[model samples]
Target: MDQAVIPFDWARMLLGEEPPTFLLEILLRTIVIYIYTFGLIRWIGGRSISQLSMVEFLLVIALGSAVGDSLFYPDVPLLHAMLVITVIVLINKGLDYLILWSDKAQTAINGIPNWIVRSGRLNPDQTSDRGIGKAEVLALLRIEGISNLGEVEHAFLEANGDLSVFRAREPIAGMPIVPPHEICPLPHVEPSLREGEPSPKLCCFDCGMLQSRAETACLHCKGEVWTEAKMPDSRLA
Candidate 1:
């Protein structure tokens, strides 16, 4: 028979065969599947999609695909999809148990965190082992608002590929230690003015130059960037 202009086989389209119904059956299937999926996720724990670990992410993707296919495809048996979900959930649970109980298993599965930076210097061994370069490290530090490596006391590469940075409590004092070539005094302030003296000291940020008077331009390098050379008690790392 020639296909209808829109091929509207109401029975076959809605019910698959002539057995299940259109509005009622489809509605029931959607509700049941939704409830089941919700319960499964709840049992797995109340972690948001963003907070899901690598293993959990894969499980969510698999469950979503299986559930969606069974919900709308008449030829796909719901029971088969449910069975697959059950097996996947069981395996996930089993792996979680192993990871929790065995330290070696946990390391093997999730990997160990690498100390990318330590004590204001890049850990060359760790970076080389992980195939990370100086440029990549600098880029990540820049993203965290750290322009100078000396500002960071420590940095770690987490197992899930996130970078955690620990900043120095005090800015490292010396010229060329950090980038941009600005220098903090050896003792952080002039010794004569160190004891209870609020001196109006101005210094160039880009070039290491001690200025006697505040001017619109630096005398030595003519750089405009300048800051009062008062040492702070604490600096954010």
Candidate 2:
């Protein structure tokens, strides 16, 4: 017999070798569900493998139940039903690969994670931009068993939809003493702003660091503000 098509009797027997179309359609449906489920979840923002907020967690359960309901309906024809599931799965996989292979597709499907914390401090604009709160921040920290603010060195709300925590052995230095280079200013602001705004309180110039404010002449290179601007950018180790 040609393998591309099944004989009517063969189809009937398979639909229910014992009862309904033999389990072949169910098996095909299962395979489609598995491949698409795994791949689609990957593209939908990494919720499958990571800790999720209450809303995110609920979405997974609802999606799984909806798919399961469609798979189990008895009135649907066996082969046709399986093909429908297969089509849906293929669409999912295709989208997943598109997101993986193209940067633009990724940006379109899921926006980036904003920085909730920078320089060991809360970033209000960034947090508000993403609609995240300090309560969520506390929860993320508690998962890492860090209850105190001082213990956390740096934390990031990562792009793959995860809260990445960085705890250092030494607590970050206090602003009163460390040079300005040691500080990381918040996003959306430039360095070298005067004090009307809440810029970093400590001035590197005051600490004998090469800056224009504390001294008219930079102590290290005797360079003025323009010369200081040309200095190499600082690197964090």
Candidate 3:
């Protein structure tokens, strides 16, 4: 039989239908979960909360539901929630230990850093494999105050999804990314130059590898498209 629903039931709203003794249990449950979670976080070391790994992300989702539901829901048994949290933390800790000891486990779980640029030339294979496009790389370079691809000697896509760039001590003439591609689109065709004439500073459109005027395809990226290489502006350096 269903009891009649009442409007503005103060006792039901304020205290819920759980026994008064459950309130004490709720306090103990909260304390235990909080302490246990905090201790586990400390054990996991001081990695920034902002940079949560895949395993840590799972921990956050599982713990958030378990802790929140166990706090207020009368039907959610405190012991069950505690056990769930324990198992989750244990799994996380175990993965951490495994990652520390095994290079294969660490690479599998967190991935390895990818070299996206080397010697002012883009690594097309690595970028394509990592699903990083040329536009994205250009944006990252611009964020680092790069005006041209030649300014970068080496650039790596870190496992944590951060781009690390190393600048060349003596910058070379490379493909310019300034003024943005949206504002000024790159040229696709090679410039016509007389035979025996020195190649007019042309670079491969795809990988920024310097190209000879006579070459139909880029030796590095095999891209036939060419754009005039821009010397690094002293003011922008």
What total of clashing residue pairs does each candidate reach?
1, 8, 0
Residue runs of model 3 more than 4 Å from their true location after superposition: 1-50, 68-75, 189-194, 234-237
Ranking by TM-score: 3, 1, 2
Instruction: Name the top TM-score candidate.
Output: 3
In the range 1-237, model 1's lDDT, one tens digit per residue, is 954433444444434443443435544554466446544544332213325555576578767887898677666555555655776676668779989999997776555677887644566566665566655665667678775555677888765556799988874521222332224322333223354654355544434344565466656557665544432223321
lDDT-superior candidate, 1 or 3: 3
Higher-TM-score candidate among 2 and 3? 3
Per lDDT, the best of the predicted structures is 3
Candidate 1: residue 143 lDDT (0-100):
72
lDDT of 2 by residue, 127-152 (tens): 55555655566567667665344345
Shift of residue 15 alpha carbon in model 3, Å:
20
Output the worst ten-in-a-row residue range by lDDT, candidate 1: 173-182
User: Lowest summed-lDDT stretch of 10 residues in model 3?
Assistant: 41-50
Provide the clash count, candidate 2. 8
**Alpha-carbon local distance difference test for all models:** 0.56, 0.46, 0.74
Q: What is the clash count of model 3?
A: 0
Deviation (Å) of 200 in candidate 1: 29
What TM-score goes with each of the models? 0.49, 0.45, 0.71
Off-target runs (Cα >4 Å) in candidate 2 are 1-67, 70-72, 168-170, 173-237
What lDDT is obtained when candidate 1 is compared to the true structure?
A: 0.56
For candidate 3, the TM-score is 0.71
